[model samples]
Target: MGEENLLPNKQIVLKNYLQGCPKETDFELRTTKVSTEIPHGSKGVLLKNLYLACDPYICHLMRPRGLSILSSHGFIVPGSVVRGYGVAKVIKSGYEELKEGEYVWGITSWEDFSWNFYPQQLLIKINITHDVPLSYYAGILGMSGLAAYVGWNEICCPKQGEIVYVSSGAGGVGHLVGQFAKMMGCYVVGSASTNQKVDLLKTELGFDDAFNYKQGDLRSKLNKYFPKGIDIYFDNVGGEMLDEVMLKMNINGRIAASGMISQYNLKEPQGIHNLFSLIEKRLSVRGFMVLDYKEKYPEYAEWAVKKLQEKKLVYVEDVITGLENVVSAFVGIYHGLNIGKRIVVVAEE
Candidate 1:
């Protein structure tokens, strides 16, 4: 290919391993040239990235390589593009299954263009047979949605009339969990850090009740909302909240341990003092990685799409339009600035 055909690819790279809470200064943006053509004999796909999702786990992966198993996965190498889930269009492909011009969602670098060598495992061809927004693939119809689905429907095995509580309930996964519980006829209550998010949960997301964790006493809030005790707890924020929720859990209740956003940036994670409650109340607390349930994506995607079409499910997104502002958008999530799924629009389809 000629130099004229090359495009300027912008990338956001990690400057160093994170220590405490992440800031925009932790990342650097640079540009490189890339071709739109796939080289001969290559088995990879060249992608035009459209949307990128800012997830809490990305902070964990930013730790030094040996600090944890997740960081050791080669996800964050200093001076290289940060890798995360995104929606992209195939510009050139060597795989027969993925055609040029098709859209996909999966693991891709934080760049305007990315080259994926393992499309079979890392990428799923997006089936846009409905009028669903493509940005939804970056969140609700993608990993976030899948995480909520597996954690609630499979892990919790919720039943109608169950009283459920979701921490960070207006977040990427938490909001969906609340909606799913409501769909099952369960009484759902959620906790966020802001009154706006609390209002979003009760008014927009259909939660039975919602509270701001930053408000008065957490235990008192729990008592007022769940006087009967919580049957299911979808925990997204760990720390003192988890400790308090355990004390009010119903017997034989289930707890889905999702992301611990509160502890991800801490030098030492906060300890939970309620393990005895698990044994005493016979509660089931399970920690799950969404990738383990990859096979269920199709099933979950179908259900979400149907609900979205029927207006039975609502998805909210905090969208930043340019990749240049991605760092600010990402850092905002930790401080509870985002009301829903935080995503950056790299390019418009």
Candidate 2:
């Protein structure tokens, strides 16, 4: 190499196993040196991370916490860098398919510079031909988009004029799920934690109905909105909301079991009392993990991008500037502070 490629990389390290809900203090920003060199005979890539996608699931890896949100995954190493989905630029790579300067989005560390040693599949490169912002790959064009697609279309196949309800209606995945359901000719309703989000759902996102779930009794609200039972339920906050929806589901209804953010922070996750309704209603409650659908990612991305381009679909994002704000941006999701996808812009590529 003609020049030395040492650079200071600022990263967020877990201070310790998070005891409860995560706080800014739970993570500490530390700087490390990165050499923009793909080690001899090693298959790894050096990345200049531009954006970090923050979501409720990232909070589950903290060990000082509750029920296993994702089974068998070990806790994050306290003094080590934590990883999540994000957008990055390849600074150097030994991998054949990934050339330097290519943009990619996948599981990346909470750092300004990340050395990804995983397979090309985990560090999948983005298709840069789209005219959208590069940061879009960190969110609507990333895993969140796939999750919304699989849960909304793949799992809960909606029929024209069927009723669909989504919890956490203003959330990263929930927001898009509602839109996709509506596009398919389904009459969709969403539940948000605040009035502002509820309004956006009805006005901007084109949901047929939206209500502040915190403002009124859920059961009564469902009765008011759906005189008949719901035909499809896209569950994002799956605790009390799931229980209520169970009672208001039509026979043979479909419930797409997405993330249960309401239960992620609890040591003991809440149980649904009306599971018998699942039996009586003969409902099909299905859950999906986005990683399992990677093979179809290209197809889904193309279709979703076309939807956005043609103005058939719309999205919202809560972008916080600076890598230093990564921890706070993540914790904000559980509080329902973000209206849509929560993203942390770490640096410019």
Candidate 3:
């Protein structure tokens, strides 16, 4: 639709299935000509990806050699583009409903230009009446936000004055969960990787207390903080963290297993020796995924946006520019390098 100089595209391809922890070397940058205009009579639309949300769960898709199942959450083949949730602008459209210049957010690939068929799944349109940053739709208003809400309300079902502890508290879902817990009048505590993150949780996110998991003894630290034992554990990081929390959970406690970022990269997961404690304490630990709760998106969105408008809920984001840098941006999530929601600003228009 335009001269070669007018349309430029940047893309990423899967180099290989990672053996253990994913490295940036497992992805490669590729470029090609991409026109902003869609072809006439085309059944597919073209989009300029504006933001890419990096989530910890994505690490599960990095299959190791000889593994039969590539991903438990989603299948990703070698040489295919990495997929994620993002916000984009429709430069071209084949459907009568989706017009050019409209903004949409949903599951999208890690690339500059994407032809989103079944727009219902790949592209969920955004109403700009809110006029918040487009990247906000990619994180706080997108899947990560839904995870926080569903994990807390649907899974944990907390009551007022309940003690809530969230692992990876400064992360995308963890941050929002802490705020929502506070809004519910629950006593909240969070665990983060750094002292600055702990400070942010205590002072900014309104947690009752927060601890840096990297410093000192985890069990000793948790015991000191939750002297009476935790009533609910919103687990993001697993392994020893979960084990430690299991030892300190009260009778009839609930554990919402949102994710285990600790085990995503490990070939064999570390032992959770305290599972027996669940029986003695009568604790309930349940794991869930968002797709199973798609029916709740509309209701959850309404509730969350109202909180946003009323200033009852807040979030943070770490944004990088250009599709060229998306690989590194995603790598940051696995390494605890990003403080908030990690997103890549791929292209504006």
Candidate 4:
């Protein structure tokens, strides 16, 4: 490849390991030139990034190394391209399964283009047979969707007429969990930080009731919404909220401990003082990772696609154009600035 033909690749690199809440200054955007051609006998695939999902869990990776369990898997290093899930098009591939011109969604860097040498298992080929939006693979049909499906269906085992509650109800994953519970005939209630999000849940998302967690006492809010006690709790914001919900759970209730957005930025995570209630209520609390349920993705994807086509399911996305705004878009999630799933658009497909 000629040097003149090289493409200018823009990237978002972590400036340092985060100490408190992430700031826009914590990331630095840089440009570098790269050739699009794949090397001979290489097992890598070149990608053109389209949309990137802004998830709260990525904040955990920003913490100092050895501060959390995720550090073992490798934390975000200073002056390196930030990594996250994104939708991309295969530009040049030495791998047979991932052919050129195909779309894939998986773990890719925050750059305009990326080369994945070990994509045999990391990148998942997107099936576009249904003509759905490619961006959906970054949110509703991707990790968020799979996380909600496994947490609600397999872990919670929700039944018809059951009472369910979701924390951070309008988030990327929480929104889907509430919708799934509702589809199963469960009466669902969700909590958000703002009244706008609370209204979106009840009026648009079909939740039975919604509450702004910042407005009143946590226990009072739960009591008002779940007078009969909650049977299923899809916990996205842990810490104090989980502690409060434990006291209001019905006998044999199930709790899916997904993400803990509340304590992600805390130097010392808040302690849960309601374990006694768990034993008293015979509650089952299970912390699950979406990767554990990879085999069931096809099942969930089929159901999600069908519901979407029938207009039975609704997904809202707060999209910001350009990689320059990626830092602000990500930081906004922690502060509850986004109404739904937040996505950064890098390029149009």
Regions of model 2 farther than 4 Å from truth: 1-3, 64-74
lDDT of candidate 4 over 1-349, digit per residue (tens): 6887588999999998898899998999999987877787998999999999998888778766534433223578788888888899999899989899999998888999998887876788998989779999999999888998899888898889999999999998988889989899999999999999999999999999999999878888888888899999999999999999999999999999998889989888899999998889999999988887889999989999999999999998889999888999999999999887899999999
Summing lDDT over every window of 10 consecutive residues in candidate 2, give the lowest-scoring window.
Answer: 65-74
lDDT (C-alpha, whole model) for all candidates = 0.90, 0.86, 0.83, 0.89
Candidate 3: tens digits of C-alpha lDDT, residues 1-349: 3385256666788888877787899999877666655556665667778898997766666574433221322656688788878899987888777889998888778888887766765567887777467788888889999888899999998999999999999999999999989989999999888889999998877899999889999888998999989999999988999999999999999999998889878878899999898999999999988767778988887787788788777778988887888888888888888887989988775
Q: Highest lDDT: which candidate?
A: 1
Candidate 1 weakest lDDT stretch, 10 residues: 65-74
The reply for model 1, stretches above 4 Å from the true place, is 66-73
- Give the Å shift of residue 93 in candidate 2: 1.0
For TM-score, candidate 3 versus 4, the one ahead is: 4
TM-score of each: 0.97, 0.95, 0.93, 0.97
**Candidate 2, residue 235: lDDT:** 88
Better TM-score candidate (1, 3): 1
Cα-based lDDT at residue 331, candidate 1? 89
Error of 3 at 185 (Å): 0.7
- Report the CA-based lDDT of candidate 4 relative to the real structure: 0.89
lDDT of 2 by residue, 54-102 (tens): 8678777877554454443346768988788899999888888898889
- Give the higher-lDDT candidate: 1 or 4: 1
lDDT score, candidate 1: 0.90
Identify the superior model by TM-score, candidate 2 or candidate 3. 2
Alpha-carbon error at 193 in model 1, in Å? 0.7
